[model samples]
Target: MSEAVPLPAGTTLGKSFEYGIDINLGTSAVPEWQPFRRISGFQPTFTPTTQDAQTYDDLGADNSDVTGWSFAIAFNVQVNRNTATGLYLPEIEALLARTRPSAKGEAAVVEVRWYHKPEIGTPNPADAGQGRATVAITRQNTGPNGEIEVLSVTLSGKGPYTEIANPFDGWDSTVAVIGTVGPEGAGDGDLVTITGTGFLGTTGVSIDGASLAATDYTVVSGATIIAALPAGDAGNVPVIVTNAAGASAPHTFTRGA
Candidate 1:
C-alpha cells in the first residue's frame, strides 16, 4: 500500500470474472479481502503419482525478504490403466521461484489421490485364485519298513500364472509331497502314472513324504507330462505337482507288493 485511495461509495472492487469497476491504478492503499479474478486458463501440467516419487519444495526470502507462503494450483490429471497397481502425480511445479528460494512455504502433506482406472469388464482370474485346498493321504510303501524320501514337484496352469503357494510346510507325511507307486490293486513293481499339467518339469519326486529323484520323464505338452515310477517303499501316496510357479492339486497313486 502506497497512499490512501478512495472509490465511489457504491463501487465494487476485487470481484473479477463476476463483476468489478476496472480501476486501473498505479498504487493503492486498501485491504485485498476478496478475489480479484476468477481462476481460469493454462494450469500446470502434472503427472499422476504411481509407484513413482513425487515431491516439491518452494520458498523465498528477502526481509528485504517477504514472509513464507505456499501456493496451490489445481488441474485435471489422467489415471493409469492399472488403477490398483501404482501411484501417479498428475500436476507438478517447481516449489520455489528460482529468483527467491529462501522464503518458507509449508504444506502439511501431499494430498493423496486414487483415480479410478479404466473399468475392466472382466476380472483377472488370478484375483479369484489362491483358494484353500484339502489334501488326503491314501497309502505309502516302505522298501525295508523304513520311510522314503521326497525330492521335488512340478506344476502347470490354464493361463498366464500370477501367483502360487505351497501349503506343505514340511511335516513329513503331510508337509512332504507323496508319490504314487501304481493304480489300485497293482503290486509295488507295477508302473503307475501321475497325471496332471506341469508334470514334465518335475526334476524330483516324493513318496510318503520323502523327496526322491526321478528316473525318466517326458513332457507331453506345455501342460502334460509323464514321469517314470521312482524307486521307493511300495504304496499309494498323494502326489503334489509343482514348479517355479508353484504346486498343483494333489493326486494319488497306489503302490503295493
Candidate 2:
C-alpha cells in the first residue's frame, strides 16, 4: 500500500467570525494549546493614548503624540459537551485557575493566540499570529442567548501584542497595520486609533488621497497613532500611514455621514 499523501484542499480564507482562539494555561499537562469550542465571534480592540498638542495659535485640531497603546479581545465560546473531557470544563477550569489571585494577590498571565487562519491545513505565518499576554479577565458571563450556555470572555493585554515577523519580510523598512479598534465607522471629527508596527516618525496619515493635518493626528509611538477622521463623504476610504521607513499597506476606514 502507498503512504497517504497530503493534497491541497483549495480552501478560502475565512473571516474573523469563522476563526477561533487557542489559549496556553501554564499548569496544563498538555503543553499544546486547547482550542475554544463553538466560537461565535472574535473581536480585537486597540486603544492609543494621546494628549492634545494643539497650541493657542492653532484651531484646536487635537494634534497629539502617540504615547502608548493597549489591546483587548472579546469573544463568545459555546459550552458544548466534550465526551472525553466533559463540556469545556477544562477550559473553564483553566480560565478560573489562571485568573485566580495568588497568595500575594498578584494576577497571573494568560497567553492567547488569535489565529487569523483558523483552518488547520494552511500554514500560518508568525507575523500573522497575535501573541497577547492577558493581564486580566475583565468580564465573563453565560446564558446571553435563550437557553444555550455561551461564555463571553474579555481579555486585556498586559502590554502591546507582538506579531513576530520573518527577517525577509522587510519588517524594519515596512509598515504593518495589525488591527483597528473602536467604531467600525466614524463621522467627521471622530477619533480612531491605528495599531501596528513601524509607526514612528509618521509624516502623515491619508484617507484616500487627502493627508490629515498635523493638528488632527498624533503619533503615539512606533506601534500606535490616534487620528481624527477628516471631513469626507460617507463611504469606505483607504487609510495609509507614511513615515521615513515607507508607506504601509492601506487599511479601509469607513466615514459615516
Candidate 3:
C-alpha cells in the first residue's frame, strides 16, 4: 500500500486579484504610492534577452547566455473619476501628465511597484518588485451607445526590477493596529470600544485568540470598532484585530470578574 503524503498546514490557493500594482506619482524623495485601480486584464511580462553561445563544441545542442531582461505591464482602465474628490484616478492623471509635450527627459518616466497581496498575512519583503517605467496610453474606440470610455495603458520597464517591501503594508488602511479598548476591564458580553488605526476593513475581532462572531462586532470607522467581549478567563487577555492585510499584534486587555 502507498503511504499518504501530508500537506503543509494553512495552505491556500491564491486568487487572480491577489496581485497589486502601484505607481509613485510623487518624486523619489517623497513617494506617494497611488494604487492603479479600476484596471482589467492586468498582465505583466518579463522577458530575458539572451545571446546565442553555441560553439563548435556543441555540435547539435543549442546554448545561450542571458544578457539582460525587460519587464512590462499592460492593463485596461475604464474612464472615471472620484465623485467626491472630482479628480481623475491618480494613475490616470500621472500617465496623462507624463504624456504632455512639455514633459521632457525625467518627467516622462514613472516609478512603479508590484507585489503579491497575501490574503491574510503580513507583507513579505521578497514578494514585491519596483522599478521605473515609461508609459504608453492608447484610447480604445468608443462603443456604440452607452459603454464607458476605456484606455489601454502599458508600462515598459526602463531597467531591472529590484525586490523591496510592500509600500502599502504600512498604510493606515492596510495594517491593523489596536490602540486602546475602552473600559479595559469589561467582562464577557460587554461592549467595548476599540480605537486604533487600520480598522477600515476589519474582518474579525478576538479576545485571547477566541474570535467573536461577525454580529458581535461593528466597525465604526477606520480607527474604531465596537465589539462585545467573548468569554475568557478572569484576567488579562490579548485582543487582536484582523483584516484582509493581516492580524494586528495582540493588545493586552483585562477581564473583570
TM-score of 3: 0.61
Error of 1 at 181 (Å): 9.0
Which one wins by lDDT: 1 or 3?
A: 3
Off by over 4 Å in 2: 1-16, 27-31, 81-87, 99-107, 118-146, 165-257
TM-score of 1: 0.25
Q: Candidate 1's residue-wise lDDT over 1-257, tens digit each? A: 76878777754443212211111111111111111122222121222322322334324422133233222222221222235854322221211121144423322112111111112221121211111111111123336765432111111111221122211111121222334323564553345555544442233444445543333443333234444554556565655655434565556666555
Q: Mind giving the per-residue lDDT tens digits that candidate 2 earns over 73-181? A: 8887666666886655566656666565561222456666664444343333342334555443433453556666666778878778766321112224565563663
Clashes of each: 37, 4, 0
Candidate 3 accuracy as lDDT: 0.77
- Where does candidate 2 have its weakest 10-residue lDDT segment? 164-173
Q: What TM-score does model 2 achieve against the real structure?
A: 0.46
lDDT of each: 0.30, 0.63, 0.77
Tell me the spans in candidate 1 whose CA falls farther than 4 Å from its real position.
1-182, 187-189, 231-235
TM-score versus the correct structure, for each prediction: 0.25, 0.46, 0.61
- Candidate closer to the true structure by TM-score (higher is better), 1 or 3: 3
